[model samples]
Target: MTINRHCPTCRSRQDFRKLNDDEKAWVRAEGSRSYVDNLWRCTAVGCLTYFRIGRINDRGLLPEKFKKEPPADAERP
Candidate 1:
């Protein structure tokens, strides 16, 4: 499972780091194949948003609830 180290709030690709080894392992255990409860913190200037990184399945992660739905125009003939 690959975790993204980018800040979801600011969308910054730098200055963001993963949690400690122990924490990561714990998160993996708690999450399922469809979702991994990984955590990340942004350290760019004033941006201090803590976010959860997880696997993207038909539905999104635990905290961020997302459901996939087809486009409205897909049924057009």
Candidate 2:
């Protein structure tokens, strides 16, 4: 079932659902933690963007050894 969640691209609350297996695999291929995270995708027409509501990257709650660092050449916004 879909739930109401904020869609960053839509800039509004929208319907969202859990990622399917194919979607999860794709996310995993992209090296995203969201594949195993409490991730959701906007279901609004033409807006299938993804977002996460989990603590997968909450460093404060994680051990130092598990913390991840972006690649040196990765650009920061």
Candidate 3:
């Protein structure tokens, strides 16, 4: 997959930043107001998905999986 730092979904070079100050304060002591961060738009065309660096946990280090689990009985329609 060709990875582009730019926003492929919006096709816009401008991707907005994010700062969850309210949530961050409640996260931990080390995570203070200075922990403000920037988020990136999805690299998929027309997807328009924006996410933060902390949001990506491919290693499953998160306390709980951010993604929903597939149903065991899911069947092909």
- Whole-model lDDT per candidate: 0.44, 0.58, 0.37
Residue-level lDDT of model 1, residues 15-71, one tens digit each, is 544545554554466564323345554445445344454421222222221222456
Question: How well is each residue in 19-62 modelled by candidate 2, as lDDT tens digits?
Answer: 67766666676664633456676666556466565532321121
Displacement of residue 37 (Cα, Å) in model 2 is: 4.7
For model 3, residues 31-59, the per-residue Cα lDDT tens digits are 43243334333433234344454454311
Q: Highest TM-score among the candidates is held by which one?
A: 2
Looking at model 1, residue 26 earns an lDDT score of 47
lDDT of 3: 0.37
TM match of model 2 to true structure? 0.60
Report the Cα lDDT for candidate 2.
0.58
For model 3, the superposed segments whose C-alpha errors exceed 4 Å read: 1-37, 57-77
Question: What are the runs in model 1 whose C-alpha is more than 4 Å off?
Answer: 1-4, 18-38, 55-77
Residue 53 of model 3 has an lDDT of 49
Model 1's lDDT to the true fold? 0.44
Root-mean-square deviation of each candidate, in angstroms? 13.2, 11.7, 10.0
User: 56 in model 1: Cα distance from truth in Å?
Assistant: 9.6
